[model samples]
Target: MAPPLDPEVLRAALVTRGSGWTEVEHHDSIGSTNARATRLGRPWVVVVADHQSAGRGRLARRWDAPPGRSVAVSATVPVPASGAGWLPLLTGLAVTEAVEATTSLAAVLKWPNDVLLPSDDDRKVSGILCEVVTARAGPLVVIGAGINVSQSRAQLPVETATSLLLAGARVTESTGTDLVVAYLQRLADRYAALVEAPVTGGALAGPTGLSGLAAEYRTRCSTLGRRVRMTRAETNGAIDVVGVAVDIDAEGRLVIDGPGGPTAWAAGDVVHVRLDG
Candidate 1:
């Protein structure tokens, strides 16, 4: 088992980035970090929790994990001056890169803001939640991440879930915390660059922007080239869609092709299918 998180140790690991961070013993939920950070209105300010009582995911699913066995952190970043709304996508790319760098695991990104494992044999290792908060200064975006680090099977809520330690991936407390800090730092750097660039009036301009990001995401995504079913709360039935897993458009909408032809699903729950009807 990894050692407990030391404030000094975590702070030291994060000092290189020059960002303010706050650690808490326990939180009602890490999902609330975004809201808390927004009220603080400080860029690069982070809120971390040892345990989340009411953590949440996409579609309001509870994201509870055993205390001290996972990492839950949230950071707020100022919106880029370029007016690019796709900053969340950029954040996802940064996380994917960081996870790959630290664990050497092939991290795949699901549409919008989910980071999944490359193999079906494994469960989701990480999840991202992005929320935009309007303040007197302007729009501040809070990005929250939850990662499974050192939990066992009995500690998890579902059998379909997994953790880094359970997967035989070695990650000490220092290394795991450092990994989260690194990803946040990288995300801040990318956002800073985007803000300084001239307004191109598109999703992400330049040769090395969102378009390039999409390309990288496509390669890591296992959902591509497979058949899947999407269910939405409003819909009475599931929609069968073939996973072309192509590039996401500027607004971060996924493009999929079904037997009926081509369709763009704006929002829904995505499930990969093993067999087709």
Candidate 2:
């Protein structure tokens, strides 16, 4: 079982790791940790909030929840590798591994960037949000992560959401901080490696030149092989796209074979479903 979280203990662990973090601000409540990190203008920094007044997810959806039971953290990294667009995918993998290290449940990745738990419940326990900021120096990537640590079903806003505790995780208050920090370290290590040797071309060619990450993403993604509804930016708007998720292209785009033929989805909202349903 994991111990409870203590802010002071977390601070000491970070210091001992020699992370060279420019800042580590603990907030009672914040609109968004990613937004806060972006506005801070520093690389290798972490922002954590006990409560989020207005946490956000992809497509600007609300991600707020009660404080102290979840881990909401954001970190900023300077100009990544030449072909580092796959940072989001890599981050997802790192998060999955980190969660598994601390708990017994098997975690899976959804297309793009969501961590899902196995079982008919199909609830989302964690999510990653990536935002890019361009500067004269280069691009600054802000990666935000949220994990449901201790909330119960009654405390959840919707049935579709879940927490580690509700899922039979053994996490004490003292262990939460260590678990969060461990995950962050894993992310940092992966991010550093990506910056060093980004997947550039050849066999692993992606739309954004991060095909290796895309391939790994496919292995753990549950979105493939399911009927899906996609809302594209095109005039047609929402369309039915049902097919086995064939693969993700080098540019990190989703490739699906449907009645209309093989299509590469660049951007849109995808909801997976059972064909019979």
Candidate 3:
């Protein structure tokens, strides 16, 4: 097993002049960082684990990484109910940017929350999850993220996943600590920018808010402009649609121009398909 996270080292790495982050709890292993983070009432606090017994991804999918080869983290941030919807998208962007900047890889997002290598040779490298919690102080959003780092080919959990080591991430010299620090730093700046925008006037798409964010998301997304098989869940049941993905609207929904017509979806499993299909 890898050495557990040292709080003093993390404190030195995480300290920012004006950032409000106060506490950090590290574990060699845990059930889930997200589950633990939601139980904490304080904002700007973070939880991290080297291994997870029951880590989960979107749609309650099982997710975990090999110990010492992944970074699993969860952070709590105070946010309004209106802004809560944007956290998932924002978290996705944060992770993508952080990975690209840190690893020097052509990383991109695969809509909603998966981060991939590139469009032509795409493979999942990271996943993000955002959940809401209520406490005595108010409401908070717990953002959880996991990244495959130094794992070798034989160690990968799935055939469709890649790692920083495989991607030739030259800058990943130190360890996972650098990655956690980088991701949290970027997330902090992104969250601060979101807080500066107007929360009441739908300014999430406006200048001060997530304005150009959607466009960045679009550019880095391998889903748009490709044929996709989408499976979306509903209260009644589930439906599958095969279509050409056109755009991601300001609300972060996937716009699909399909055989029947055009539809936008908020949640779906997107499988990129060939034109022959």
What is candidate 3's CA lDDT for residue 23?
Answer: 82
Find the candidate with the highest lDDT and give its number: 3
User: Model 2, 163-266: lDDT tens per residue?
Assistant: 88877777766556766677777777767555555343433344433445556667778887776766765635657576667777665677888888888886
Which digits, one per residue and each the tens of the lDDT, describe model 1 over residues 168-206?
666865756667767876777667666654446644556
Q: For candidate 1, what is the lDDT?
A: 0.66
Better of 1 and 2 by lDDT: 2
Q: Model 1 reaches what TM-score against the true structure?
A: 0.83
Q: Is candidate 1 or candidate 3 better by TM-score?
A: 3
Query: Judged by TM-score, which candidate is best?
Result: 3
Runs of candidate 3 with Cα error greater than 4 angstroms are: 1-6, 171-173, 199-203, 233-239, 275-277
Relative to the unseen true structure, what is the Cα RMSD of model 2?
3.6
lDDT of each: 0.66, 0.72, 0.77
Lowest summed lDDT across 10 adjacent residues in model 1 is found at 20-29
Name every residue pair that clashes in candidate 1. none
Higher-ranked by lDDT: 2 or 3: 3
